[model samples]
Target: MKPIPVTQKLSVAAQLQPDDFQELSRLGFKTVINNRPDGEEASQPGTDAEAAAAKAAGLDYVFIPVTSSSMTDSDVRRFAEAIVASDGPVLAHCRSGARSFYMWVLAGDVDVQGFSDDKLVAVASNIGIAPDASRAWLATHRRTGKPDVKGFYDSRTGSIQYVVSDPTTKRCAIIDPVLDYDEKSATTKTEHADEILGYVTDEGLTVEWILDTHPHADHFSAARYLKEKTGAPTAIGAHVVDVQALWKDIYNWPDFPADGSQWDRLFNEGDTFKVGTIDARVMFSPGHTLASITYVIGEAAFVHDTLFVPDSGTARADFPGGSARVLWKSIQDILALPDQTRIFTGHDYQPGGRKALWESTVAVQKHSNPHIAGQTEESFVALREARDATLPMPKLILHALQVNINGGRLPEPESNGRRYLKIPLDALEGAAW
Candidate 1:
């Protein structure tokens, strides 16, 4: 897209992307103002993507959104303030440059010096923006907010645990935390949980919820342990019952309950909750497992095992109840979110021995994530199946599933106080050497 200059201090573009920031920086743009709110239009870029790009390009980025239906004075003021603070030219963008151009013209403090409203209207007209209609919209939009997120890596399972918090009140939710386990000694430890606990304490964060993306096959869940430590209620996808039922048969436990009674709360799709004042919701994203669900909290989504890092491709779907076919649908759903949404994944294999990385945007995944970037459902399934066929099962799958399916609780002792694990031999397929 071409940039239209309004003055020496500013330029307007219809919308900006992470890749666009570099050229804008080269063009001497010191600041970028996002006049688009997150999820305003499904699949449109969000502030996070633009901000990350701007940061990498050494440009200051600010989010000052204005909906087409309602543009408030506060929105204009915020835009004006960001423009005024820039040391070089500024670039402001939205779905169409109309919202941005309208904000610049309406933002009384902006330096549109010799151009009056009439001239601004003419300039907008040439750019195909209906200024009058946008003016009508300007007559009512407010700005939007963001979330606070942090990730912790467990070296053992290559899992990434996250703490998503409400900055205003410091209330937070922990997502997909790992339980430290040693298969050689059959020992369980709390180092992973302790790190999260320590961070929460140091940050003065109130643990509002303990979440498990699914019953992990790679590592034991720290949900129950974290809840015990923090007294926070635990939650998992409602379909965990299905997982329990499936695994119960495999383990040959006749009397085990298949109902999901272990978790404090069971989340179905579209279920909403709060961590402090920030709103969060659930999306059923299965395929890595039957119970895998994503926790979307205010522009950030914890998409566990759906899509891996761009370099690493996606998660395997050859496990029980797993389907690369279904995973394609799930990934499509996630990519349908605003492009700027911050996606914190569950694991990172540190491909090529690189450092662990979990943070990426929906935009990045849509274009670069090797697995889903351009492949169709049929192609993805073919490729995923081919790859999964060559990879061995996770080291702890046998040990972890029993504990994870039982709400991360060790089994009851038989007469003796010592707990024992039920490792079913010849029960699971692909029992790799």
Candidate 2:
């Protein structure tokens, strides 16, 4: 079976491809669930073909097509039964990977008595999905008192990096990690990444993937550094090609490559992958940047640099290639998630004399975020444009973009055979404003 390209935190058999059953059998996924319905206006490889392939691959296959607007209790029950009866790890997939993920949450906690209340709410939050009526349904029906996993947050970076593991599975993946840097020295450090690495090593967790949400402009992406230390493959959103192009011209680097082939794997929206027991999917979320993406690990959405702490409001959209209108639309999609969904932001700049804080619920952002709360599209556009106009470029804008666009590697060696960075003469006269 060909390996499907999933989101960052999840792991899939390397040989598995979309609708590839033979490889799936070889890789030991005993069951396959096609969450995508047939006959949508969009062209898709039909479910029938996948079903036929699954059968040929000697795997139990089920088709539980779900529409975007409608997923019912009966659907949840059927999905749960399939999971319980499956002989081995299961593969569930759908368009944009969200529907399949929603189903996973539904099935994972279907037996709890308050499935519609507490358990469901907790699971959705754990996996970064917004809590809503659907989550309430799972919480109301939840039969288990103990959560399947636990989660934690870091206050200083305003990022919610997680350590997800199942005792039974012992499989784990770290998502959207913050690698602290020493700005004064122009050197890099790994205190944050080290903590994650220590946890994985101490707990005997196999680190499969070191992922980033995008080539961030505000904070450095430690994917390359972490990969070197952990021996994990590094990845980012595929649209990073667009970012590379944008910055390439801005820096006027004639020798730089344009196509976004920098990262090891360029994940597209709806892509799915695996870590250990967890399956993750990608949601193409732009606005923060041309390539910003959310990695949905199990039920959590690692929404990097999109929405900040709810009270702090949303991310800035004034960077090169960023559009306020597009950011508004992207945030709308995020807000549409279940209200209880956990939104792990990319970076946090603490305000109000508050301690650095990261992680917030969708409900909080929609209701209290000062910048975009109750803001109409037009109003948000106007506000964002005006605010952006008054803002100064990031202190490390030039340095950050050049390094990030190259997947975090510094410039190649010059004619002197030494890697060096250049500062354009007179590039910033009164431009400091």
Candidate 3:
């Protein structure tokens, strides 16, 4: 049997023979799990014979036979228990190795702490194996202490602002809050920020952080305003410096500080923080923007700009420093999260005039997103590039970036006591006419 290593401790193989048991023992496998049912094929070896061979070969053996239609939660738990009880490495086998691979995938749902979702997807992709029951498995499993998510849709900008809170502690964070701007009159207001503040006050929530997933292009960020009102620290991805550098030149501001010092905190990938008792982490997801990030708080992930509603496909990747291929990889990384993990999109177009939606599970995105379900990296890049070429830049990109890059602070007032935005003409060329 040719064994395929799924992880450092687990390997899978097509039905093992009696002779192969000794080889497996010599190869340091401490346990053998049979995922194949007996007597389905007359030529197949029975579990009893396999068990005896494994015993004689000085290896522990367990039979957890699973059929395509008969695999259940109990079977997955037993598989996880067997692995946990094993002394060393484990070698599981099934008719064609696919069943064992799937069993391992399902086992992860029961043993989330024992497995890394990214590692599982990486090995599964390497072996050309994918779980068919991922959605069903996630639907039945529940993770405790999931954060409460509330989405506030801004129809004018089509951006979704969020307040993710730990229900037990009543501590919350405002994510991607919008600073209302009316370009026609060149007026800015705190209507959206006040609405979020009202929710926090009504719910008796304490604001611990004001987080921005990225420097948004469509609307100005209310991060600075919220911080001043709440006295909470403001933060964004550390890569904001790169974006600041690129935009600083575009704006022709030589005195601009591009060191990402404007914000109270700059989070790197894998940086961990807390909102009350809830654990949160950062994942750098750059494609639609150079500094885009996803804040993974408990079961909810604030994936800003990289992914929109599945029906809306992904975001445009033709912005400065954006790459379609890079965006595809970032999308895959988000999809690799646990199927039950809640995916919170930053914006939704409400395609076909449906009500706005910002919440989806990783399972839904995996199975339903048109941009991801059937498209490979090469095809997705081609599609993204072709589509982006036909779309014009956001209306407020020039107006928003100046304020956003400076940590959502409006320009200093002149001696006349009035502030103004600096718009660079023809800076973004080749945009759709």
Give me the candidate number with maximum lDDT: 3
lDDT of 3 by residue, 44-117 (tens): 88999999999999999999999866778678767776776687999998987777777776554322322333
TM-score quality measure for candidate 2: 0.62
lDDT of each: 0.81, 0.65, 0.85
In candidate 1 the C-alpha lDDT for residue 201 amounts to: 98
TM-score order, best first, reads 1, 3, 2
lDDT of 1 by residue, 411-430 (tens): 88888788998888887766
- Model 2 residue runs over 4 Å out of place are 1-168, 413-418, 424-432
Query: Which residue segments of model 1 deviate by more than 4 Å?
Result: 1-145
Residues 1-433, candidate 2, lDDT per residue (tens digit)? 2333222222122112445677666766788877777777455667767777777778888888887567775676566556545767676666545566566554443222112345445544444447785454444433222122333344533455666554446676666666565557766677777887887787787767777787765455566777788777778889988898877777788878867666678899999987675677888888878998887765556787778876667777877667889888888887876554556666666677765555555555665677767799999889878877777766666666777888767667889987665545544334427
Model 2 weakest lDDT span, ten residues long: 7-16
Rank candidates by lDDT, best first.
Answer: 3, 1, 2
Candidate number with the higher lDDT (1 or 2)? 1
Show pairs that collide, candidate 3.
none
